[model samples]
Target chain A: MTAQQTLWSLKAGERCEIIGYDTTLAEAYRIRLMEFGFHPGERVTCLQAPAFGAPKVYQVSATVFSLDDDVAAYVQVRLEPRDA
Target chain B: MSKVILVGSPNSGKSMLFNRLTGLNQKVANFPGITVDVGTGRIQAMPERTLMDFPGTYSLQPISAEEKLAVGYFERALQDPEVDHVLCVIDATRLEKSLLFTLQVIRDCQRFGKPVTVLANMIDVLDNHGLELDVDGLAQTLQTPVVPLSGRSGKGVDELLASLRNPVMPDTNGAFANAPDALLRGEAHALSRRFGPGGELLVRGQARLDSFFLHSVTGGISFFLIMYLLFQSIFTWAAPVMDAVESSLGWMADALVPLLGNQVARDFTADALFGGVGAFLVFVPQIFVLTFIIGLLEDSGYMARAALICHKPLRLFGLTGKSFIPMLSGVACAIPAIYAARAIDSPRKRLLTYMAIPLMPCSARLPVYTLLIAAFIPAETALGGLIGWQGLAMFGIYFFGMFIGLLIAGLVSRTAEDRYTDLPFVLELPPYRMPGFKPLLRNAWNRSRHFVTKAGKVIFAVTMLIWILGYFPNYGADLGESWLGQVGHWVEPLFRPLGLDWRYGVAIFTSFAAREVFVGTLGTIFGIEGADENMVPLVDHIHASGLALGSGLALLVFFAISLQCVSTLAILAKESQSRSLTLKMFIGYFLLAYVAAVAVYQLTNALVA
Candidate 1:
């Protein structure tokens, strides 16, 4: 069995296909994640960290949202090809 | 005579369209993430109908307070036969994102047998970018009446109103399964691809700017700079206007003095009317500037990011990101600061945030601090003559008060009972837009007027009581010979250990209603005691009193922590909504202040000797 890489593993300016929420998370948090298009198969790209803190900006398609490190770590994702 | 409910995802121009139709201005925030305030007004075009504007929400599943409120409105509106139609306005530019909510509203409205229309707002953007939307095609696909309108310019607003006059219910299948955690992404995606205009340029433009603004390095620096500018303007810009207001009040008070025959009436009219209300009125400019700047920041869609940036540091102090704005707002005044705490999602965090606000060294404390600093702290330069000693003292007092607030927050979080529900730190970052000034100015004006009226009444009553107390038993012959003086003498022993006299005790007692009242109360006491020909400046009176440095320091510390303002207490009672919590804060802080003040006074008395 392979361990899944989460959105937290994505570095600055990286892209990934969101696998969905980590099942261990509470239902409210999971629902919120899905509500903002963080559901399975959505293409999410990490734009950058706000330079100082744990919260990083990610584009969930057209809408961009910032997630704290604690919560960001729970969003499972598959890494996409690096920009040439 | 049916109620037309305006519902939409936040910032979809729903409020704007409602405002246009009703000709009533609601607070239209640029920050779409904020909780919606239910605003109902009569529709100008259709006088027989009432229009209700709800908070922007994505779906029936509630997340934030606004969402909860909106969903509640939806259910109650369904129950009430008065709710005839729903105007679900969606941003035309972000159709793919908004269509999810649009589908939900359409489905629900149809189930309830209420007619609904889809106002595809921001259609003006399509015209500018050389783009076209298949409006009729979207109407056909959703089976809902779709009107391409710009809420900002009122473009195609007549078409929307005409449709509202005779709302044709959408033909959606009403098969939206009432799933608690429904994932409609697949359906929303299919709808967007079918009917969405593919407004890629706007999203791209937003991405380009967001990359720069949310960049780690630049974003942090810009956040600090903007926040600093915001606080700086509150202090510097407001001073001149505050002075102008104070002087005009004085002029009014002086003009009325000769008209009154009785000395007691004259003093009552002068101090209670002019001094009390005037003092509170002077703080309005600072509040105005703070609200304006905050509105601008919120409208620009940076408030959430700013809160996110603040989250890490605030969490260290046992607070969430939402506490940042309210805490910063505390520097200007705490009433609005208390109201601002509504943005916090967590109950515990909101309570913790409320505890810190009162100790934030509000602008009301400014006059008290300045008066004391001018009297005792010499204007000597320190640090190789670079920094003024008095200025440093002022800064120390403000920072020290904030330190105590943070310490209390940390303690509360540690002792607070754990909740079963784990409230997540999920914050919504709304897209930025140019704020409308008409509503922003009106918002600031309304808040200022509200503070003046609500808090003003309490201050006025308190001032009159103090006036009546001081005027009695001698008919304004002598303040030291009045009922207030007798009470002052009785309470003098309580403050005796702190080395303060009965007159100081009297001043402090009156000040319990409002902190700034200490200065005016003391001034009136001195004026009657000396029975002077001219009114002496309160600062000069303090200078002549030969107050011990230890006692002065003690009084300063007391003012720093004391739950002295009744207006703040009234606001806290309203905000916290728990009588126990409000009382606990007031009494708890009062005792903490008393002990701290006594300790400082005694320790200083020993050290100085």
Candidate 2:
């Protein structure tokens, strides 16, 4: 299988589509992810990543929100190559 | 009186709208047993009716404790015969995201046969972006009358008020109560696309700024600098205003001193009004400043980012990033800090946050700390006079309080069964807007006033009781011979293990109302001891008493850790909705403080000997 890219794999100016959430994560986290508009097929762009391995800001359509590295890791994403 | 409910998602300028509608007439009450604040304001235009502002929630699907409270209030309001009209505040910048709650409210309102008006708030947000919205088209689609207005600028507030005057019943024939959330979201997206203006240009502008704010290196530096300034402003900046307020109250007391014919009347007014309550009121400027700064962070949409910065470190202690704001503000006053905990989404984290807050070295503790340091710690300068011994001791005490708070939070958050069930970290980064000064300041003033009135009422009463007990029998002549002194003698044994005398016991006992009362209480006790003559400087009194250095240290430790403030307990009880938890925390912290104080006293006493 081809390698999977998570939200944490992206940096500032990088963009990707949310493939789906890691189902093995807690149910509450999944609900929050959806509530935050991180549903599958939604396009998202990485806005900024702070120095600490902390929450990174991302924008989807019009909504901008921060996702922690752990939670961001749960969201499977298809990323554009760095050279693209 | 008719009931008007204001419902909106978080950060929809719902509060600004409430401020515009109600002004300073807002009264904050607890929701029965819950810690939730129920703010009701009299509509000045229609004095017969009252407006109720609920906690901001995204949907009726109550995931978080805050959402549960908001939706719970909405449900109960639906059954209330008084609640007839609803105002659904929607952010104009993000109509699609807002419509979910808007539609949810409309459907529920339809169920209850109540009319609804769509308050398209923050229109100025759109106006600045040079975008235009077809308000009529959007209103037509939703079958609700949408009144476009900026809650910040108050541009269309008159029109919004006019709409509220004749509340229009929405033709919610198309709304379905059981419509799936996904369906609602899809419909909302479609509705925004069809009728609302395309508006990501403003949001894109926000991205340019977020790059700097959310940059790893610069963000961390900025966060520390802002927090440093926050604490500095609370201390150094508010000093002049605090001194002014104190002197004015002193002047008033002096003016009243001669007017009262009897010594009893003069002492009562002077001590109770001028000394006890006045000392507490002097901290009011700090509270105002604290709330204003927090309000600025909140309105400018920087709070979420602040939370993000603290998320990782805080999570180690079982708290989310959101708890940081409350924790920081806790350094100012735990009353507002407890209220600020409302912003935290997770119940467990919020509870733990409450546990950590009172332990924060709030400004109320400043008087006690300063007095103790002046009496005990030598005034030698260190680091080429950059830091005085007193300043260093003050820093140590403040650090100790916050340290204990973090330790408690870490322990509490770690041991919980559902520790990992944190609601996903998805704090919204709303586009930055210039903070609306009028509304923001109005909000800070109203909250500060509410604190003074509600919390102040309890403080004033407690102060009066302390004053009365301290004054009677000998009529301020012999405090040791007075009733309060007797109570002090009674509690003295309880504290004697820490080498404290009955006089210190009196100060400690009276300070249960608040920590700052320790100074005034001790002052009066010492005043009685000083040959019934002019009161000596408190530091000189302490020196002459030949009190053990260990006992001074013990008192500092006790005040640093103990949850002594009655208003804090009252707020904790209301917010936690568990009198048992409040009782448990009170007894537990007091016992903890006592044991710690005793240990410190013994250790130091042994070493000094």
Candidate 3:
């Protein structure tokens, strides 16, 4: 089963495909996210969730990017199958 | 001469490629804005061709101040008649993101009718991982010459040089230049998916390291240890060289002072040249050691991870993770740190960073701290000699200064009017690599030379003036009767509450020119005072004078808090563009330093009593 959720919902080592950004996300941030290759259909993997509420690291479109939880919450994604 | 603009995203090895092409030791930091000034150098292969290394940027749209500066200069250079070509450097391993920026550059170059070449950097990493990128396909798709090269390994650089001889313009029709950015973004994504390296090779390697570096337990432990080591190394590693410089200066004074026939000339040579400027020269090695360690952190890409770790805590102080770079750079010197502040996206955070930078325990403060600590703090070791008391004292004062800076930032950011909203904390974590020692050593040497040639002149002039003023009339017989003594006594009351006499009062005033001048001024004063006929080090002179420990500690506190350099004030005025802000900071810090020094002085004396 496929579930749609915010990118922040993905735990460490989880995989997802970009769907779109939330409508509530500001235009400036949306454009920047898109410029960073977070467009629809892009694949992302959660590489790390640093302790004490530090920004999490994610692999977006083959490049690593660190985003705070608030910004990550705006990126909508669909869960991808886990590797064996 | 034909000019080429070198542009790329931050951490794409663009600066390294510039070094490879031009053979210049232009700094390449893991973070952005290492090229705050446009560095121009002739290409090593074709001396007639000049390359301009612009500051790195993520997008042509320009978000941060540095990006805006880069994009602005890039656009203006495209219009300049002398400009010939635009070379866009990209990391082949992270092809998709690099292509996102490359696509924008290509689109912009098309609009400007300028020829563009795509230099795909860092293929050595790809080769090690056995990943592949289709250079020809990428070139065919973009209609620009794609030269894949390893900036670190110098592979494919000859081909890049050859390609530069006959640069090609985009063969696209007029319609391509008008494509919307959104459409170009989609096209870049599609192109990378087809031609970029396949699978998860790059991210996996970075992730494995991040797991250890970003872990709650290990990361925290390593961070403190690394920071402690940085301060400790500055004192311990540089001590032997410092002593060598001291003894050599002593030998030179011994040989040179006797040769002078005239008594006045003998006193001037012994007091002003050797005693004053010579004392300042002993601390130069510490600046070299500081620069080397910081460069190691910067080149190895640990600076970015440190920034990431500092982000959450730094934000509470009304600064971003980005401010960490400038603040850390401030530990070396504040002038470049002010320039490095350009990378910070928000004006509000940038201003707060400026406020904190002057408070960082910079190398200029090193001489005074060493002098005072040697005079007051004992030379003892603990943990079976693993840690020296002097290094610990250095670390304590550094931490104390930084803590006070953060407190001031927190207070100011809370009370000040919010003009610009805060930008999100987005910092690029470049893949960790072993730092190239050649560039680090070269940069350290250059920094030491720069400190000497620039601040050395000022210290020399100040030393000469102090020597003349103290030597004249009574001719060093009675320092209390000298001209400088009279001037110093006039200001002595202002410093008396902090337990400083007139000689120190004079040195404190002279130090405003440069913080290192404090030691030189004191050296000259004591030399005129005839402290020792055999020329003891400044520490011994301070000890022989019987300066109270409380007064010594007070001086350390004062130097730590005060903003002493005139160049820093000048740059603060130019960067902040507000004379009032610079003046307010100068006055405010002085007042705060005075109050704190007096309190420390009283408290120390009370405890001792």
Candidate 4:
């Protein structure tokens, strides 16, 4: 699925599993995500989406990180439905 | 001696590596036209060596003037025959992005024909992540000798040092063998094209981090909490050490007093030297502790997180996310904070941030705040032992600094020319890694030494000057009859409504050198010898002198907001490159201080009546 489909379509507080990174953007960013343990198969939780569609705050493991809309738009994840 | 310059992104552990190479031989100097510190140190690498820890930057490309200086230095060093090696430090955990800069360095080395070495720092962190690098593969790929060393654990330090001692030539062929597609094709570029090829990488790194960290709200909150913890830690962990310093000063004063038989000499020794200088000295422990923690956060790459976090709030103040790094540094000392503002691209905004930074209640303000708050506000527990009102009051004063900072920033932003649309908040959140102790200790020691050496000299000289002023005209005859006493009396009418005596006025004036001097100034004015607990005696003196509570409250408010330190002002002037801005900052702050104090005192008096 496209990055926009995964991040933008997901509701706030939704949990998702990282599928992989879309490497079309800068390699530095892709590597930075990898270094932060945001690899495929890791669970990620959408914490907050700022008003007027600002940056999104996500909880990856115990650490809280904020992603700008552009970066958020490049991260690909599979949304975990509420039940599972 | 051959000189090697260590350069890398912020939090890449470059300083840590620099310490490993240089030990305690490092000194911090300002790059011309900017406030960022360039740490230089001499290392004895098998008969001859010197290493300079350049200010951390994302790329060689210049975005702001500071990056330009760093890139400029890198190029100048390349051309200078005195410089022999360029140690390109990379955070191995974030090697992909780091390699991008490394490739640029290789390109620079090619252009300048300077020998270079790749240091894959934080190898220990990679190990912890269950990741291992093919150092040999990376070295071959980059055509450079890669030394996998952890600056924290001392692991591979000897090997790294050995490499420095016996330098190796960078393999020209492998240098750009593994360059990313964009860099190789020259497709992606940084905003620093204004400076030509020299600044491209630097601008790219900054742009990348700026996009993520500057505009994000969550990033802002996270930044606030990190800074809040940093400030909170200074108050919490440093207390015991600060108390020890206070006790030591008391001991020294007691010991010195008996040796000096003359009353004037005795009082000067106890009150002026020990009392004035000693009070400020007590904060050394807190300063060292805070500096150490900040160094760790910076070395570990968390400081970038802090900058990113505060970006949103800082932008409101006409500062970029990068401005928060310097402002956070300002908590320790405004000198470095002003320099840290070099990362901000906009000249006007940088000047405003630099001017307003000193207003933040730095560690120097702690002694003043502690003394005043102790005298005026009763320490009361509130709401099921969840909080101490005294602690809350202290926090409120700190909160007041931030509140005023934002208000001033917002006001300034309205009047100042909008240099550019707000820069994107893009920050690469570097992976969390453990900081090594040796580098941490070295940094702490170096900073503590600098504070004691530089700030201490200024404070010592200023204290002596103020002491001379307050001491002469025979205040010993009867404090009421002294020159300082007469001066205080002259000013007393202005302050009488606030319940302050001439002594309080003198103390407030002396505090302009450094805030903690107020404690000693009060001690000298009151002629109370060997009182480590100066607040009680001070309060008693004020109460017996018949000053109203309204005046006490007014003094508290004045101390809370007044721009009291000359060093802070000097730093502002140096950073902003505008004497008028510094003067305006002082005037604006002092005016606000007077207004706030007067209003608080009058209102409190009215409410009490």
TM-score of decoy 1: 0.90
Best by DockQ: 3
- Candidates 1 and 2, the one with greater lDDT: 2
- Please list the Cα RMSD from the true structure of every candidate, rounded to 1 decimal place: 3.8, 3.6, 5.3, 8.4
- Judging by lDDT against the true structure, name the best candidate: 2
Q: What TM-score do all the candidates reach, one by one?
A: 0.90, 0.88, 0.82, 0.71
Per-residue CA lDDT of candidate 3, range B1-609, in tens? Answer: 988889998888887788778887453322233224566778888889888887777778765555566687788898887787898999898877777788888887888888888999989988898899899998888878899898888999988877778878665464457777778778878888899997877777778888888888998898878877876766678889988998999899999999999999999988788877787677678768777787788899787777788889898898877788678767867766775576576667888998999999888898788878878888999999999998999999999999988989999999988654556665567888899887678777866775666556666777687778778888877666788778889989999998888989988977886787777668767773332222247778788877899999899999999999866776676567667888999999999999999999999999999
Q: Each candidate's chain A: what TM-score? A: 0.86, 0.85, 0.88, 0.84
lDDT per residue (tens digit) for residues B1-609 in model 1: 788888887668776678788876443322222233677778888889888887677667765454565587677887789898888888887676687787777777766778889999989987887777789988886778899999888899899888987878644445453422264656776666677676457666777777767667777778789988987877788788888888888888888888999876787777667766566777788778777778788777888878877888888888888899999888777877887786676667888999999999987777788878877789799779999988998999999999999899989888778641235676656667888777667767866776776667777777678778887978877878999999999999999988889999998998887787777678777774322222337667777887888888888999999878877886677666566777899999989998999999999989999
Residue range A1-84, candidate 1, lDDT tens digits: 888899877887788998877878777777667766777887888876665565777777556777886788898999999872
The candidate maximizing TM-score is 1
State in Å the error of residue B282, model 3: 3.8
TM-score of B-chain for each predicted structure, in order:
0.88, 0.87, 0.81, 0.75
Candidate 2 C-alpha lDDT tens digits along B1-609: 888998898889887778778875677776754456767998877788899988787777776655677688789898899997899998887776687788778778877778888988888877877887789888877777889998777788788778877878655455655567667766776676676667579778888878777777777788888889888877788789999998899898988799989988888888788877786677678778877888888778888888988998988887889999889889888987887787787777888899999999997898888888888999899889998988889999999999999999898776767732356677888878778787667767877776677667777788788878888888877888999999999998999999888999998988898887788678767764432122238888888888889999999999999999988887677677777888888998999899999999999989998
Higher lDDT: candidate 2 or 3? 2
Model 4 docking grade: incorrect
For all the predictions, what are the DockQ values? 0.51, 0.62, 0.66, 0.09
